[model samples]
Target: MDLRRLAVAAKPMHRTLHALPRPNCQDHAFLQMRRLATTDFSFLLPRRHAGLRSFSSTQSVPLSEVMPRDGSRADLKILPTDPDYLRLSVESMANMSRSEVSQFVFMMNSYGAVILSSSNRKEDRLAPYTMLDRLFGTPVPHDSMNEYGIVEINPANPTSINTANPIKEHLPHTDDAYTENPSMFCTLQCIQNAPSGGGETVLISGAELVAALSNKELKSLMTPGMVSLGRRPASDGSWLKVSSIPMFWVDKDSGWLQVRWRCNDGCVQSIDSAARPAYEQMDAVARHAIHQLVIPLVSGEVLIIDNRAIAHGRRSYEKGEPRIMWRKNYVGDGEIASELRNGLCPSYSSMFEGMWSMFEPKLVAV
Candidate 1:
């Protein structure tokens, strides 16, 4: 860890706790000989929910179809990139004065995420991913839109819910595992035209998901948790410290949110033991509470959901043709999050305290 960084982070952010919070409207891939071969239907899907229903589950709606997935055909089905979407471009936002920009960010921050669309491809500066990255640090690396695997919609693959491995889709989730200091926030720049299928990304408000759950369910989810990430075996025959983080942790002073969960390769095999219980809990409670997701999506439309307070996923693809999007994930900047943004990042000290605590038990006890 950056020691100079740690020195600055050790100080306590004592007075920053009272900052008012606000609300806002919100809101991967790879291939190497194909990570997923089309073999078993349950390849990495959940056994229970992975069982997609009929055409609704197996088939996806393609962009070419003027008919809705539900069988409603029309002369012109609305695409996510329709003229209405481009109207929300960042240039439109730029025309807003400084105060307006500040207010826009303030409103969006309070609400957790925002969306922007444009007719321009990735080059558009005001496009979804670029704007958010400029606002927040680059959160996480993911497959470029050019790399997103495209597929046709069929009933076999219903909603893009993860049953077995989450390492597949970068759902409308947070940037990292549970902690108060999340990365600067995640942004996805839509890149492909689905001609069909992949019409919308879906999300459930994390707060709403929690609110809708039963006490028994919530209790299990709130406990100190960890995640068991997987990786290659080491010389010692042990896998890498894939990662062990809680699903949720509010900062001691400031109430910023933090989270950690799996998407794609991170979700499968060789998970750390510490994270198992929490992962299981999340899966269970999240199962029933997930009905909160009914949001639709489209090309050029960007979806930014709070990883802390929301769970996100995608709609089924349009059969024979699929939509693709370029994704760049992010974590909120926690260390600089104090009301006094200029002060040292608290997480630095938090880091040393973490280091000292480990050895202090044995060193001091002596």
Candidate 2:
């Protein structure tokens, strides 16, 4: 069984702190946060790996402290190499106050991405996914691959299943843009760094692009039927499942903006011929947005993104240098961790079939 599967059940609840002690900032802001966003958080974290113990599945588990067992403060560095910026930590994340939680949420909502300077233990991926699951809903797991484990971006070692390609520069695009319900949020944790220093992560803000586009471009984007194309690879490295999705849509329930932009050659060809002009305009605008924020992530840091509001990509790195990253996706606004403890959401094929079934009729109508 996978470690993640072990974490879902049988593991006892506990916390791991960093080797060094940290300051306890019990200020007024912290107090206010504790007063407001009180949610029992221990059930969401992975239990201590070394000391395995049993717990009653039916009993109410006390929330444990989040231990910083992975990366250290020294490993964190700001993009463009700024030395004075304050580094964030993943230690004790389960114990953060309501205000602190609100701040993180606010940053993600407003800026479309938030960076946390922290260490990642093998089990540390649970911290962010659990937190997001508590605040949002269950994380929609990756379909093409099970385990949702470490995805190493090794170009020289491209596999049929992995999304991270080390040698190739990934253009700005939403992760799983090909899926029916693309992951609502994506979290990336760095475990190893490239030796030659090339693969910087690039981010583009949808909100920024929306604000900058002319009314004509906005109208074209909002004009309903711009299909973005993509494919799923089979076990034998063959592309088996081809999919098409609208580039942008408004969620009927939330009235919020959602996007499915992919600039890859095949994806671009999937755009409706009638909508080519609009696609060209959107392409230009998206390029401008990403140029504004390029981030170089090193080991011991995590980047969380709002999938609906931002598109992210990786810069090409020097060949032969190694880079490894862990990624997890979470879904929902009100879902909890325990509900999804057994496993992530349905497989991608099933989810996509359902989405396409509903969409085919609409496409015909259009």
Candidate 3:
């Protein structure tokens, strides 16, 4: 039988499966069988590897060899390059044309992060916020801040160890990992730069990290309730927490991998002792030099990161140095502009479907 023809025939059945109400065991089994029938056929489709290659500049490296067994940081230095590190010579974020905005969206979706530099000198702090609102939607409000969800990252007190501190290195972490639904995207606009150097932004692609994982490690990371994240006070004077959460899962809607990880001391309440080794291995992979992109944002430069796809951190700068950044988190509108969406290959979903299929049974069993 021609698998292509079977795949085509299976779509109507899949739609019927979706139309049915929430599935019970029988229905779920039927759905899984149907999905396997269709998706397995995807393997026979004409593969378009070129589009996948164009999606990101970084290539997957062997996880076992990428870092040392002791998990120490590598001495290698990886330079900033292409799609991930873009330098736009535009005057200001507000002045960007429609095409430029489209370009930004495409690059962000493809590479998972982008650094844009502009010449706008006006102290209009709202510029970055407004631009983000236009692109991704409303910002996720800060725990205790203005309605705009803007948080200033400046060297306020040298003793503090939070984002406001410039003396300590901020380990790579996905913002809002404590929350059940973390922000889909985040932005950092450099209002000022540290004159003494340092404070460079560090980014690691979650896709690259996932690609390097062993099956055992991936399974351990994906196990729900194996981790506990969050420890913040809610409005009712009660502490908010996600007592059980997974470090990795595939978003059903977007077919994109989602990762929630924070290396902070208090944020991660606990990890399943059984899965501790895998969690530590993941951290090691993220910190490996080959997977890191260190970029220093200068004044008037804005950095946008797909929080769902990349983890970001900062290098410690000279204490009391005048470095300032405006930070905000945003939830996607679940819609991509036509100009940007058209550039992506339709077969992109096929690439992740196999991974999702591999893990679906385990997720369902849990």
lDDT of each: 0.35, 0.48, 0.59
Q: Which has the better lDDT: candidate 2, or candidate 3?
A: 3
Question: Which residue pairs in candidate 3 have backbone atoms (N, alpha carbon, C) closer than 3 angstroms, thus clashing?
Answer: none
> How well does candidate 3 match the true structure, expressed as C-alpha RMSD?
13.4
Candidate 3 lDDT by residue in tens digits, 1-366:
787887687666655554444332223345345334333356456644433333122332233453222211111111234333354445677657676665566455445676776567673767755566777776787754456777777766221235555677777888788777788778888878888778888887665455556544665676777778765442232346554667776564433346777764445677888877767777777777667778877877788777866788888888778888888877776334222221111223443432333345344222
The number of clashing residue pairs in model 2 is 9
Model 1: residues with Cα > 4 Å off, grouped in runs: 1-90, 93-100, 118-130, 138-173, 178-182, 197-199, 212-241, 261-290, 318-320, 333-366
Among all candidates shown, the one with the greatest TM-score: 3
Per-candidate clashes come to: 65, 9, 0
Could you give candidate 2's per-residue lDDT for residues 1-366 as a string of tens digits? 354454343322212222333323223354233322221233234423311232222232211111111222111111212211113454444344565565554334324566765343444544554555566566565543345443444444443333434566666777777666677777777767677777777776554444444333443445555665555442354454444655555554332346666665343436677677656655666566333467777775778776776777777776667777666676755532222111111111111121222222222212
- Candidate 1 Cα deviation (angstroms), residue 347: 18
Residue range 1-366, candidate 1, lDDT tens digits: 554443344222211221212111211011101112111112122222212231322233221221121111111111121222212344442233344345334323333444665444444434343345444444553221223221212223322223112223434344434233444445554555445444455544344333333322322333433344443321233443344444434344432233444433333443346444534544544444233344344555665544544455554443545454555555544322331111111111221121211111111111
Worst 10 residues of 1 by lDDT: 70-79
The C-alpha local distance difference test score for the whole of candidate 2 amounts to 0.48
